[model samples]
Each structure stands twice: as C-alpha cells, then as structure tokens.
Target: MPDPARLFQSLSDPVRLRLLRLLVREELHVQELVAITGLSQPRVSKHLGLLRKQGWVDQRKEGTRSWYRARSGDDAPGGTALLPTVLTLAEELPQTDGDDERLVLALGARQAQAKAFFSAMADRWETIRLRYAQPEFDLGLMGGLAQPEARVLDVGTGGGALLPEFAATGARVLAVDLSLPMLVRARKRCRGQAAGEVDFCCGAAEALPLGDGACDVVQCAMVLHHVARPARVVAELARVLRPDGRLAVTSFCAHHQEWMRSELAHQWLGFERTEMERFFRLAHVTPGRWLQRGPRSPDGSGNGNGPNAADWPEVFLMTGIKDADHGG
Candidate 1:
C-alpha cells in the first residue's frame, strides 16, 4: 500500500496537479508540457520527477525527449484509488483559456512542420524513406497466408509496395486507394511484373468497391488512421473477405501526435490494443498473431532504438481470420 499522506502531499502543488490532468488525457513530451502549462522547463521537470518517483506517472524516452503519461490500474501504486480522485479534482478546477490557446499554437506548429516535410519530399518519398531503418517485419509472410490464385484486396495501397509481393504469390491482386495519383504511381511501379495479375482501383476504405465475400485476403497497411470511420472500414474489410480468409492490418499505436490530422490527413491519432481487439470481435474475425515495433528513423538508415532514431510513429501489425461460420 502507498502512503496516503505522501500521495496527498504530491497533489498539493497546483502545477503538478495540472500536469497530471493533461497527462491523463494523452501522453505528452516535456516540451508539450511546457507549452501547455506555460511553465518553465525546470519547474515542469521538477514536478514530473516527483510524480514519477511517487509512481503516479510512467515515462518513456523517445529520441531526446521524454514522454509521460498518468499511471493507473496495476501500473500505479494504490492502483486507481488516489489517482482517479486527483484527476477528478484537477478537472473540477478553474479552466485556463490561455492554456487551450497555447495548445492550438503548439499543435499548429507541429502540423506545419510535417506538412512542409511531406510537400518537399513528395516526389522523392521512397528514396527519402530509405534513409531511415525500415520496419523489420516480413511482408513475405502474407504470401504464405494467401492461397494460390486467391483474390487479394490491398486497401489504400499507396505506391503498391506490397502489391508485387502479393502478385508474386500468384494471388490476383486488387489495389485500391482514394488518390488517383497514388493509384497511377502504384500501377506504374508494378507495371510489367504485376501486368495481368493486378488491378488498380480508386476507392475508399470505408466503402470498398467489391461485393461481399469477394476477397480471400484483405490487407491494409498504415491506412486506417486516415479514414473517417475506422470501425466501418474494419467492418468493410471483414465484409469483403470470404469465410476462412485473412485480414492483415498495420497501423500506428495510440500517441499524442494530433499534428497527423492536419498534416498527413489522419482522422484518428492512432489506436489502442483493446480498440483493435474489439473491432476484430465485432467483425467476427478471430484475432491472430500481433506484433509491435518502436519508431523507426525517417531516413531508414539507423536502428530505431538509437538516440538518433527519428521520432517516427510507433507501429503495430495485427492479423485475424474470418470465422469459417461467419456470414458476411
């Protein structure tokens, strides 16, 4: 059991309490904390250090920045007992309109930075990505999960990186994306190799063009967060996959990157493991292997674990199979 007196003492500072309130909603880096709270770095670090020592917060180092989130449940001492009360108290406190305004500015700055990077590198996207360490997952595994001549649907198949992989498996591929320019690039990339094996379609993930039970394997890579309704897209993916077919999705894990929305056109920041599991259950897809990887460098040159690792998004790869008895 934690000392109740010490816990109360920790929450006595208004600054610490405010920090806890922000952290409870989203994981934030020290710079974000400073920006949100209008506090000096020294003061913010001091308060965070105390919260961490008391086991009221957890920290993770990403590159040069340290990210902090409120700890709850089994991860926190005394579980949720004191923390929930503190959070509630923090919420009940007077609101600071300036904090909200500053937050908007901070997020806007991040969005501008991302937008500029993407705009400048759009033509050399693939070459620029090679500068960072690529995600270390065997895409070849998709071939084994697919049957020969299987109808494979690749939703949001940006430049068709995986189209050729599926094509090489002898699966007839349908690569779909909302962007006609991206679809054009994808078609060109897979030109001679995927010649007759692949078909490019301009379509949205939430409303795939194909009929129900049309595909044996449905693969979506890093696209769900961009959709307006991720759950609907999941349902659509499940609907299009035939019984006993597989659905493989790769996406970012939950994070505090709101800039993604304005800059990269992401709808949701990311997803939680529980949310993904719920989607699988709702879709009647039996969840299978799950894997998570930390941020990779944007240049694809260094291991993501290094200090120089680019603040790339943390990603996960999840798969599920449609139940044999499931009716689309």
Candidate 2:
C-alpha cells in the first residue's frame, strides 16, 4: 500500500499527473512516453521513478525495453478516489489532449509494425511457427467446437492451420488476417481440403471485420501474442459471436524468451493461462475447457532454446462460451 500523503503528493506535479493519465489508458514504453510528453528521456524517467516509488505505477522490463502503466484497482494506491480525482483534474491540463493524440499514434505504430512483420514473413510463417511446435494437433483438439453447417470464424488463421481441420466438419469457415500474403497462403493451403467454402478476410484482431453476433464459433490459434492488445481482441471476438457461441484460443504459455519479440514479431512473450481467463471474463465469455501441450520445468519457467526439445514451453488451449447476458 502507498502512503496516503505521498500518494497524493505524487499527483501534485502536473507533469507526473499527465503521465498517469496516459498510463491509466494504455501501457507505454519509456521512449513512447518521452515522445508523447515531448520531454527529455531523463525527465520522463525521473517522474516515472517517483510515481513508481509511491506505488501509483507499475513497471516491467523485457530485455532492454521497459513498459509502465498506472497501478489501478487492488494494485493501485489505497484511496479509491485518488486516480479518478487525479484524472478528472488532469484532463483540464494543457498537455492532456496532446497526450491522448500521441498515444493513439504510438499504439497505431505498434500495429503497423506487426502488420509489416507478418506481411514479410507470410511465405515462411509456417517454418517459423514450427520452431514452437506442430500446431495442428493443438488445432485438432478443438475440432469438436465446430458443428455441421455451423458458422466458424478463424481469427489469425495464419497458413491455414485451423481451416483444413474444420473443413472436414462440414462447417462454413471464415479465415481472417491482416496480412494479405498470409491470407493468400491460407486460401491456397485449404483449397483442396474438401471444404465447400472458406472465406478469407484481411482484418486485424483488435477490430475484427465482421458484424455483431455473426458467428457460431470463433477460434484464434496462437494469435493473442501477435497482437498489440490481446484483451481488446478478445472483446472483439465476443462482439462477433452470437449468444452461446463457442470461443477457442490457443497460444504459448508464458516464457522468458525476449528474442521472440524481434525474431518472430511476437508483441507479447505468450501469456499466463490466468491472463486468458481474465480476458474471457472481461469479454463476457465463460471459460469451459483447458488443455496444454509441450513441457515446463518445476518452477513454471519456460527454459526453451536449450539443446533438448524437452526444454520447450507448453502451448495451451482454452475454450469459452459467449454469455447470453452480454450486450455484445
């Protein structure tokens, strides 16, 4: 818990307050904060160091990159009204509106970088993916989610992993991806799989290119790690799913491999299963089933890249159902 007087004092600086306002909305890298605030790197670091010490901000470092966000809810400072009060007053500050605008650009830059990376790697994405594991077995595990003649939406269906499996189910499958090259590859790969139709759409996961309640089953295989905002993508999945529709997701478990961010264009280094559950709950999707493939050490550390394949981290499958009560 943060001391009451110090916590309040932390918000006393207009400069520090501005950083909090941006962080409360989105987690930002240190360089991004410098750019957004138009401040020197040392100044931004100074302010962040203070907020961090006061327990109003949280920080994470991956390799050389560092990300910071305002600590909120149970992790935030004790006073419930502190952030709300700070944010309300901060909005009137001259820098608030510019911070919002710069934040959008920063986030957009992230998505654009991901798009470029996937587009470039489309031809050999499968080769890169195999380094993790053969994902077909993982996809096949969720095959039962598709019913005959049901509408299935496969987000991030890179190289058509989920398409061929679902094609035999007699379900109408829709494959979506932001990379045109990836979609082209997926279409060609699944063309002769004996499926009648598999529609391919070029779209990002954060804002799926589909109408509300448009799907009976939505599955995203190994995709959450690639997107800039995984939680928002889950909400978008719920938006396209009809009430009681099934949602299946597969991805690598949390790992320490920072190299994946540069080599594989992974925005996140996988996620904890608990984080996936929280995403489902926030999206009004009820988690139903869980499975894991691959291996993990006793300490829950994913120490892959070692000589033995046994050192690899596990890939997990999680299934959820869109709730009827969700307004989506």
Evaluated with TM-score, which candidate comes out highest? 2
CA displacement after TM-score superposition, residue 66 of candidate 2 (Å): 3.3
TM-score for each of the candidates: 0.59, 0.88
- Residue 136 error, candidate 2, Å: 6.6
Instruction: Provide the overall lDDT of each model, using Cα atoms, as 2-decimal numbers.
Output: 0.74, 0.82
Show the lowest summed lDDT stretch of 10 residues, model 2. Answer: 295-304
223 Cα displacement, candidate 2 (Å): 1.4
Residue 5 in candidate 2, Cα distance off native in Å: 2.4
- Predict model 1's lDDT versus the native: 0.74
Residue 96, model 2: Cα distance from true site in angstroms: 2.2
Per-residue lDDT over 44-158 for candidate 2, one digit per residue giving the tens place of the 0 to 100 score: 9999999999988889875467888888876778757666877899999988788888889988887888899889989888876665554555555446687788898999988
Q: Please list all clashing residue pairs in model 1, or write none if there are none.
A: 131-299, 131-300, 131-301, 132-299, 132-300, 132-301, 133-300, 133-301
